[model samples]
Target: MRLGSREVGYPHLLAAALLVAMLVGVGVGAGTSSSTYGAFNAAWDGGSGIRGVASDAGAETQVVYNTTEYETVDPAGTVAFVISPERGYTDAEAARIESFVRAGGTVVVADDFRPHGNDLLARLGASARIDRTPLRDDRHQYRAGALPVATRVAADPLTRNVTRLTLNHPATVTANESTVLVRSSNFSYLDRDDDGELDDAETLQSYPVVTAERLGAGDVVVVSDPSVFINAMLDRPDNRAFAAALAADRQTVVLDFSHAEERPPLQVALRALRGSAGLQLLFGGLVVGAVALVARRGRLS
Candidate 1:
């Protein structure tokens, strides 16, 4: 069972160990999830995971796997929170989402970029699009980070118990809708130039960070920042209060993961780089080592 002066064992064991290692790596990767860019179900991590404390609603939380599956949600019985959904929603898919709100269900869609899942907002009769610029309020924030601290909460029912919020790289949510639930402080302004200075071209006034609108029979709440739901921000100020307020009226909560960019041409290349490339290197090493070991030993004849 030993070779190479008792330094090597059966070649088969080495091969088997390699296979098991690869499988274990894949399983762990799938379970914990990588929080690279488009991650939403990252519940185990505190930096990018929302499951830290937000996942403890103690209610039936279902993730919409596909656009068609979103139809199963009962408008009057669920509080669906779609956070920063990737772009592209078919006409039918958009209609179904709007219908959920009209049916007296509370649909909170928090987005941060232009034309990126803004189709649903358009479907709900709102013409506003999310700006990619990171809104900041250095005067009223936990630290000098890009996160904006919203101190001026409106007197709406949604912000009833909530006083201040710690938003992570929030975008400005500008809409014709007059019911703005939360606004960045008077000193806060969009750093469009990214120079850390408020210029004359930029309006030195309060902008909407969260806005609510009425559609048909239901209502839609839009927040500028989605990072508030992350575990890292839950303990700050009244973030938990805001999160609790959103889930208060509904019997169910649906976190839509299907809306993200699940497949891209670039991702195929990345997978090959990680999986195939690594396997090739391992195969080459095994082949070279096997030939050397066999050459060093004489035949059993």
Candidate 2:
């Protein structure tokens, strides 16, 4: 390559490409994740759409990679979402979340067939509990009974315009009837035996899929299925509307990924640098030094 009277080598072009790639990675927190419902995942089953929902509602979206950061969040103006955690929280970790809720922060726990979400709910002293069995509706569903369509939505602020919710492999929540926000139809039955057929012994009944309870000055909202918040499922207008309402009035909406199995590497590194003034200064010095050296070499040429 020729630049004015000077010639550029192939090595220089390769270096430029590498630098561009690195900047792109740093800009977007590039990394691959095998875990579902990860905040950074752009995949179909991921929860990345929730970030967009928060942004569209005029709220700041924050992805918290550590539960230790929970104490730093201002409970007065933050709404936290804990979705499909890969691992259970310790006593201390659960207590931190509980404190955040009790101090006037809202928390939404969306999970199914996992003990982790229920464990957190118990620690929060909330009466809501996600059942182990998968709820199926043969009458009211999108395609199959496994994917039930919940039309029994409560007329709450969060579900104001939401008419129906399409669920994927959801569970039922066992909570006080008054606290229920969404429920399965009367024809729906719990697949306790994992069999598609409803046996004569198992009677069809209405079960709660979403519930909420007041905790001190805050609120705890439980959704039996976490998949409802995923990217693919958000295509449903009602689902997207409900998610938008959750973040609508909040100043800051947080996606808690502390118990997640994986995270974007660049995000973690940037967050670490942001927390440390020394590291930021050192990184800045290196950048300035590299630019000065390059300028000196150009002048000599």
Candidate 3:
């Protein structure tokens, strides 16, 4: 027997209530998240974040989350801060970023504690490599495992007014085209075995952790560690000063978040197809025809 209007309406109401509750739960979870990384993620405070960088320099910051491509942004004259992306960029996106840098924009790529750093470096024409081994300096360490304290740093505007810099288990970097910005102490060694103790087999010498390269009218800065921008370390020594100098420009600062967008490739393709006006109208017509057929029966039998 066909159900009455009241009976069908009751199920609809129940479903609507359940959906509302689920949505509310999701909203609350999103508000409480305190992710240390990811573009435009403001849940973290001074804990692996660049919000301090934006505030100290008095620069307008725009987070790139929904924007699929870098070319969507106008990189006329500004700084692009890309820190510790979980994934590599698409070819189109990489080309756009390179063009932005070559056209007088500044780009800062900082990555450590991961394997994704070289994705952009390989395309940038710079042979600089981020060492996989952890750089350790016992004498100047902030903690075990050689969280080195940087005292012997390069003389540059970015390092100016910086007295103390306590690095995490930072990776080492090398490049012939770039100038070394931060260096390890001579006594430092790489923990090749993951053991805290320095082994004779491990390389014992200072290495570069940060470097900057100038291309065309732009500059590209690469740092071995991205945790230096975290909120917890920004106040340590002259880290805040260091971060402030990166944003010391008149143009806006953009934090690229597209890398962390976790959508699958198939879903991305579907969304692209849905963007077409013809497809939308075709789908709309089909929906209307389905509704008309259902109405002709006087109910969804």
lDDT of 3 at 79: 83
Model 3, span 1-301: residue lDDT tens: 2265434667787898999999888665443334455432444332325655776677777655443444555565578878787778767777777888887777888887676668877776556768777888888777555678766677787677766567787888876778888787887888888888788798668888878888777788888878777766666666777777777853577877567634334334445566688878887899999999978777644
Against the true structure, what is each candidate's TM-score?
0.72, 0.92, 0.73
Identify the candidate with maximal TM-score.
2
Ranking by TM-score: 2, 3, 1
Pairs that collide in candidate 2 are: none
lDDT of 2 by residue, 1-301 (tens): 9975579999999999999999987666555454699877888988888989998989888889878887887887889999988889888888888889989999999999888998898888898888879899999998899999888888998787888888998998898632988888898999888898788767888899888899988899999989999999997748998898788788899999999978878778889899999999999999999999988888888
Q: Over all chains combined, what TM-score does candidate 2 have?
A: 0.92
Candidate 3: residue 221 Cα off by (Å): 0.8
Off by over 4 Å in 2: 9-34
Q: Which RMSD does model 3 reach against the true structure?
A: 6.5
Residue pairs with colliding backbones in model 3 are 46-231, 46-232, 47-231, 48-230, 49-230
Better of 1 and 2 by lDDT: 2
Model 1 spans > 4 angstroms off = 1-25, 35-55, 262-301
What lDDT does model 1 reach? 0.69
Ranked by TM-score, the better of candidates 1 and 2 is 2
| Candidate 1 C-alpha lDDT tens digits along 44-163 | 322233332335655456556465655777777777777777667777877777777778877777877646546778766765556668787778777763777888888877776898
RMSD per prediction, one decimal?
Answer: 8.8, 2.2, 6.5
